[model samples]
Target: MTTTLPRVIGPWMAAAVVVGTVIGSGVFKKAQKVAEFCPESGVALSVWVFCGLLALLGGLTIAEVASRLPKAGGNYAFLRDAYGHWAGFLWGWVDFGIIRTSSIAVLAVMFIESLNNVLLLARLQYPADMEWIGTGLGRWEQVLATLSVIAALTFVNIRGTLIGGGLQMVLTALKVLSLLAILSLPVLILAFSPTSEPQPSASNFAPVWPSDWSQVNWAKFASAYGSAIVAVMWAYHGWLNITPIAEEVKQPQRNIPLALIGGIALLIFLYVGANVAYYTTISRNEMLDLKGTPVSTEFCRRLLGSVGVLVGSLILMTSVLGSLNGNILVAPRLLYAMGDDGLAPAKLRQLHPRFQTPSAAMMVFSGWAMLLVVAVAVAKETSWIDEKKNVFDVLTDYCIVGVAMFETMGVAAIFVLRTRQRELTPLLPYRCPGYPIVPAVYVLILVAVVANMFIGTEQRTEAKVGVGYALVGGLVYALFLRRKEA
Candidate 1:
């Protein structure tokens, strides 16, 4: 019987996991909403920078905790250690049942759905738009694509963290290289391509605060910022995912913190550069008014012509695929941890005798994610859910509040542990630079952001779903998990 997971992933590979998981479809797809939120080019760019900072702070706060308690279930272990078994159990309950699994499902959906744009650009047709059987196979091409990636990744991870981590490093390297190519090729083409039109004026950056603020309802700005941050925060969402697999990271004592911080720092630079690249070429109006689905494709086309579509699509595909693989690789460890603690089904703790990986955990996770993909497709086909909402949007709604809420909870644990230092074993080898203030400010911002998710916009309705999921998790914890513990 397989009794353990190996700690074989080095710092570079671990940082790749953080970068790979965090840099998904959001950056490629979310600029329109960000522009819509900011009311001006500067404001929009500020949102990106601000969200990046917030994410960086979160990385710092979580890093200290992660290094101190390097384990399979990243948040699960930290929460239990700082808060108590009940807090940890509740987080694990919701994370496994909704947060992490739905996140994986959403990434898979984004990957397959985005592929449609690439296929269309090639003048190729797919069965994605057609019905297979009573919506059979549920939008055949996409469902097949989603299932194929999910299955292949599940098997890949079942091979062990090293193989999975290695796969992530390759995918992330390709993604980063591709992104650099996309950024550079455009400027080079603009330099040589004959164009009478001038590049975007520096004046666009004027009114960084938006000159018309007095003309607008200040209250509405909160709502707009709230909405935009939701998307922006989504772009920054995967930064801490590296921590969940900390136990498998070589030198978790040192590497986990480095990966978490280094990854976010890298993302901040990438995100700011991407935004600067887009706005320097495309106007806020043009970006907000884009007819094309992905703002990246259109932005690319402006610079690279028709070839931009292919570039944009490939970039998105690589980004989402890398993120999808990272998700599949790390998310199962949460279940394995829970199972080892006797809080989850014990079977999940079993590793493959030969592969020596969390085979059962990966299979269980991917199987549920496949169901979510199919259910979303079927719901779309039958019009059972909102016509405007797809699986990704619905899942986002179901968990966005919980996502922010939990991040805050995790950060607050830093203080919780400070008081309980005696509770720590060997004690943390590292600590956040500013200590209390770093985590303090981070939690304050999270509270404000989470409040906005509920009180500020039409999005409030969706946040209710997240609340319901939490309540249900609480009930399950009380009824079943608690009883088992007793």
Candidate 2:
């Protein structure tokens, strides 16, 4: 039986996973929320830059731990080695159960949403009219589309990481190039013809600070900024995605660190640039007026007219697909590692003889994600909440709190690992640049986000649900995994 995955992924592919997994639906969709929270162009831009740096700090700190371990489970290994079996198991448990699956579900749902945008822009609809299927939710078509995407990507990843990783590289390039084209659209339009109607202007950035600063309530500003940080966190959510497949990465000590840091740095630039493009082409009031519509769609409409919306929606779909593929490529490695340790089903450790991939784990993860997609859609149709939040919003709100708690602890493991001096023999290949300060700040910020979730009214119930879901993993550990470890 094949017991190991091959180290066929190179530095570029590794970097692509990091960049590709993160640059998903957030930058394209969440800018409107950021603008809503901040309501001032300057403050909104600052939030983007600030959150990007937060991801950078996280990447920097985790890179050191990854370099030392360079194992299959990434942060799973970090937590296990630094803390204990319980800590590691909880990470993997919550990961497979909620965080990772919710991420995939959200991406797949977003992909379908983007497709819907394209159809709406072109004035088309699903031909079959399956509205009778699920209480006429009118979303049966979308749920089916989301399921189809999840199934397709799951099969692609199960073939092998080489195929998956290569696909990721290509998709990453396409998305990055597309974003660059977007940022340059205004310049291109003006250069070709100076008399364009909605030309990009520097004046759009006026009132650099909130105009009514003295009149502003300091408490309200702090609350709004905190909420903005939470919104941007979803955009920068997948920084550690590459680490899970560290064993599959060639020269992991060198490549993993480079991928983590460099990928985040590039993302920082692209995300900030994208926001600049959005704000420069339109006023802050225009962005606010979107009223839940994606700001990018309108930005494209202004620049490319009707054709621009189609192109932009298609680009966003591809971006979501790249992220979905990247997540599928790496996430199952955690399950595979868990199986090897007997923390999960032994079959999960089994690799496909011909392809040498974790087929069982990949299928299980994808299946659960598809179920979530359908369940969320059904719940909305049945009025699970009075407001009727979409699948994307519900999943994101339900998953972020658990993610924040564990990831914060994962970063803090650097301190513990450093103190224990377990793997410092050869002098680490990469140490986090700012050391204690960097990791400390990263941990502190996430802790603040978590606290705000509990204290604030908007997401309190979702936060409670997320925590309860994670604790359910703890219960499983006590009943099943603890005996196996002993």
lDDT of the candidates, in the order given: 0.79, 0.84
Pairs that collide, model 2: none
Residue-by-residue lDDT tens digits, candidate 2, 1-486: 887878888999989999999989888888877877787789999999999999999999999888878888887888888777788899998888888999999899888888777666555334355333333224798888889989999999899789998999999999999889878887788799678778888788775787777999987787788877888888888989988999988998889999999999999999999999988787877777776567787888888777777888899999999999999888888888888888878999899988999999899888988888888878777888556444556667666777788888989998888888755835876788878899999999888888888877667888888888778888988887787545
lDDT of 1 by residue, 372-394 (tens): 87887788778898865444545
Clashes of each: 1, 0
Candidate 2 regions off by >4 Å?
119-138, 388-390, 422-426, 484-486
Instruction: Give candidates' CA RMSD values in order.
Output: 3.7, 3.2
Number of the top TM-score candidate = 2
Q: What's model 1's overall lDDT?
A: 0.79
Candidate 2 overall lDDT versus native: 0.84
Candidate 1: segments with Cα more than 4 A from true spot? 123-138, 194-208, 212-216, 389-391, 422-427, 483-486
